[model samples]
Target: MPHYLGIDVGTSAVKAILADERQNAVAEADVSLTVSRLHDLWSEQDPEAWWQAVQTAIEQLRAANASAFADIRGIGLSGQMHGAVLLDENNRPLRPAILWNDGRSFREAQELGAKHPELSHAMGVIPMPGFTAPKLLWVARHEPDIFRAIRKIMLPKDYIRLKLTGAAVTEMSDAAGTWWLDEARRDWSDAALAATDLNRQHMPDLVEGSQPSGMVRSEIAAQWGLQGDVVVAGGAGDAAAGAVGLGAIEDGSAFISLGTSGQLFVTTKEFSPAPEAVVHSFCHAVPGRWFQMAAMLNAASCLAWTASLLKRDIGDLLRETEAAYRSPSNVLFLPYLAGERTPHNDPYARGVFFGLSPATQQTDLVQAVLEGVAFSFADAKQCLEQAGTPLTYAGMIGGGSRSAFWARIFASVLDVPMVRYQGSDKGPAFGAARLARLAATGEAPEAVCTAPSILETIEPQPQLVELYRPRIEAFRNLYRALKPEFVRA
Candidate 1:
């Protein structure tokens, strides 16, 4: 009874899972759709509406696991990471898929980090039009005939692995969050494909997010009932498949993930880049490692925008602010409602509340939205512990860890120990069903992610780490005194 599929492609919808062999969940399906923001920090979608929400969530998960997709063998594919997805020469889709919580490609990611500061000093990174090479230089400067009908360029699971198996490929956990990976030669970055003329033969075949790269579209596996040769592996980059579904593939293991922008990651064997490039050193879905993230464009989406301006129900406003998680709120939230990424990549740093008053309640705005997503993930875990990368323990997956008082205020503001996973088919479909059970058996990516287990573990309360180390040094000096008016906002 093999079964192993884990599609994900998320950020609104399309989830499909079947997983068995130890990864459990014999069936699951999802389909939601709705991303087109049209304006305000635009965030489009519609790649045929994520291919009809992944063919109606794989025909309602193969009609409720009819013999579980006929012993589905291999499949893996996680997504939603610096999206940009573009393709043309008949591979179709040329517009709409710009997500990764679009921020109007912040001046096209600063003319690609100022015409590539050596692609961020040699593949430490620069691909930033919310990535995928500054959204292909913002569609080669505002749709130059759709960038002259570009042949390929994918993300959003390499455009659904080129619609499942027509293969245009991309892996290395979504090619090290595209800026043209070279996270120290993990692959492709011939000086960022010759400084963004970017046509490494239309860049695609990068592979290694697990393995096997073909077979799946035999008439869309009989229009979704499956039972046809599988193997669609080599998938990842939904925060390294939610750090292999919260197992954080070894190393000094860590995970913060608070979805819709907010990650801390930090597993490493080297590939750092934080010499003020402010955290982000890719490559890592395990195989020959590298990771040093640190995002946080906004966590728990400013407590879902202060639960829609206090209209309530963020679980009844965290049960009317569960005693400010054991009291202590002279408030000070700068979770940067939107505008600010790892260590200050200021998009125009806004969000604040910094020391509100009148006895601030709704439990001090729910302890300032769980202390501003634990002080912006404690400044992305201090930019991966100042590039020495040492997180030792923390695997707290998303939907902002369904708050147990914001998971004890992110385990006392990252004083560490947040290994959570109250399981609900989290991130990258539990890391693509344990990398499709380590590609059907040649195990050991930490024994198929600790036998798909770890369901609960959130420790950290030494007097709430003695009340968050001097309020994490006044939340890292309110983002360095609001970093020069959040870069002139």
Candidate 2:
């Protein structure tokens, strides 16, 4: 009856999931978190809040199922990737963490790229403002006193691990987003680090995602009413961990994640860097594997924004859009609410609703938003295919995928079947728990990490695919025509 605990330090909340040996989640808990936007394009969160959220989430889990909690054998972590958490010598936070979506470091990102012209090739990503290196570079230039006092740097979940076990360690998958890792080599790159005025000493020791990084301290265990010797697995970035959760670990396995930001992730057996195409190439959560990714900065959040704009409940709006979703609309939307990542890499990109007319209705706008996101996924899919990761089918996860109408739109636009797996909604936390089980029992991942039973396969509509093919081209052309105006305004 031993159980494993998985904790995900997400953008908006901290989630805890408990899983037994049978691969079923026994209990789950979550604690909400807040982001600070004191200035334009700046997103910060106190690291202390993350720790409190974790404690609160664990407490809730322990209270809900005390017996199951008491039998917790190990713990695993998954977190929002690319967050910059600076720490002093005492392992105390020097400043609020810079979040993954923060765009304040855009200039620094450009500066780094200027200094290292081949950075995208070496790092397997075009350095973006949301990356750790540019954030650190901004700190060094603007907050010189605070930067000078720095002692360590950690990603979001690794910061929690520092509080839990007094260990500062990271894994390859999370580190890959830092713009400091030599992804092909699976280690930190000296040239990349030096460009940001950093050295190897500033980084945590690297481990693969399934290995044990540390053990929970006795005080934490006692406070949480858990075992004292529970090992903490080297967990993954949210993307890699989500892949593990969806059983997308094997070569050529893929999934489309429609979270706050959406991604098309494809696993590979070897390191195949495709920075020229602006796709992310990173190490996989599984050992000796890598993945190439294409992402959009906005997805479900776009729907949420549309709902807010029209002053309607999200579910109600989604329900009403079902009819419009199945029909063609002249209106098109750009799902670039927080700018874009894949293909464009332009932080200046903004959301736009084109082709609006006097006859436009709320339903039409909602349908446009759904189709816009689907088109964005199509852009990402093409990037992966051009990078040689031919995906005939992919699984779908995240909040947007929960909508059958939206899932159908994605299938039609991508012209590929979308498979929905049982227990797909558990996301990264579930994957982390599976890794925890691996760490606790010395079990082989292949034996434990198999795809869940199929829920339903969404097939593409041939007519809709043809309809979207022309619309997709128009969507790109609109972006092209409006890019200058977006920069100007």
Candidate 3:
């Protein structure tokens, strides 16, 4: 029996899912890694940790005799985007990899926009410090010793792919998030590269995610109890993979993922920047396509914070929402734990309880948190609208989507329908499985999604939408008002 393995490297962990040629999931294993936060909003992870976690997951997956990898056709990769992995002349990591969650790159990001005004204009927006380009610049300025040791720069999954196939390459989907790719043209932007002092030669070769990186090296194959010569497809950025996992294979489909952070991702046919440049535009994993994305710095992060404050399991709390949704909660939560990106471009934004009173119960807080996350999606979708991206409905997936009430609230708040997904709500894993299927059998992603079984289609109630509309307007305004305060505080 031929199978495919889809491996997703995320912020907290590495997950591998086994799928048959038909793209049906059979077995899955995940291993959690750690992120170390230090001074100056820095987030670093030991790259070796990800490698060890992946090896452990593979060993565990190999233990499933019924789901053995003896004849696995291919492996697909999906990982967190924008995190920088600097390598020396021999491709060894120089130091800890700076992660997407790290906020220390703000000054460098501003410097990039200032130094390369024309390039910024061409890209439609200036690069943010949290992005790869600015992070690279930071290394060059502050840690030239580490920077000079660099021969190649790789994204998270790119490094993993290098380990598996002994090849250095990056897929367009992941590269687009680097702030170095000419997202519109689907290639490296020479002008942008020239402006930055960092060397373009340090970057790996670029390829589309669907393309095969190479055969898995014999050593890794033997270590994992698998046959050598298995084709390893370069997977996509998390957003593209997540969208693919939710079956958002074409334009017009949208997905609201409620995970570490919240994001509204819409599939599109071509490059289209938001008018306000509040959103990100990146190439899709499905080839010849793109996506418009709005990501809030906090989503489940907000829920987790609130849950920790009250000492409760988010799931248990969400169960309480069954009754809470019957009547709107009076509290309004601002889901801005790490500031925000979409529609505001302000990283100094912070969370708040705009309307709170003694009458507000735990249920009200939970509802406010859920609705607040949904409010970011509404803002994201509106940003897409400003860019003329069309979205008729939204498919909801991720950790938070497990809450039926939250899913319903997203549908209600956006005035758009939302879905409740069963099985693997982890988008990158399932989507990687689908891509592995394509690599093995050459089937279209859409063809695999033809069998439609929606868990729920929550429609917006007119009165509820009308009432939430004004509140949403206020919610959008609150972030701006609090942004200056976050910077000062």
C-alpha lDDT of all candidate models, in order? 0.74, 0.88, 0.77
Ranking by lDDT: 2, 3, 1
Summarize candidate 2's per-residue lDDT along 1-489 as a digit string, tens digits.
Answer: 999999999887898899988988989998888889898678899999999999898888878888999999889899999999999989888999999888888999988888897878868888889889999999998999989988899999999988888899999999999999998888999999888888998999898888999999889888888765899999899999899888888989999988778889998998888877889999988689999999778888899889989999989998888855556669999998878888888877889999999999999999999999989988898898888888799898776777877888888899999998787777889989988888888888788878888889999999989988999999999999999987797
Off by over 4 Å in 1: 5-74, 90-104, 108-137, 142-146, 150-156, 167-215, 218-255, 258-375, 378-410, 414-431, 434-456, 462-464, 467-473, 485-489
**Cα distance off (Å), candidate 3, residue 25:** 1.1
Give candidates' CA RMSD values in order. Answer: 18.7, 1.4, 2.1
Model 1: colliding residue pairs: 127-179, 129-134
> Which has the greatest lDDT?
2
lDDT of 2 at 40: 68
List TM-score per model, in order. Answer: 0.37, 0.97, 0.94
Best by TM-score: 2
Report the C-alpha lDDT of model 1 over 352-396, residue by residue, as the tens digit: 777877766776876776787787777777777777776756766
lDDT of 3 by residue, 164-268 (tens): 989998888888888888877777887777666654687778777766778889888877777646888767888888877777867767788877877788878
Please say which candidate is ahead in TM-score: 1 or 3.
Answer: 3
Clashing pairs in 2: none
| Full candidate order by TM-score, most accurate first | 2, 3, 1
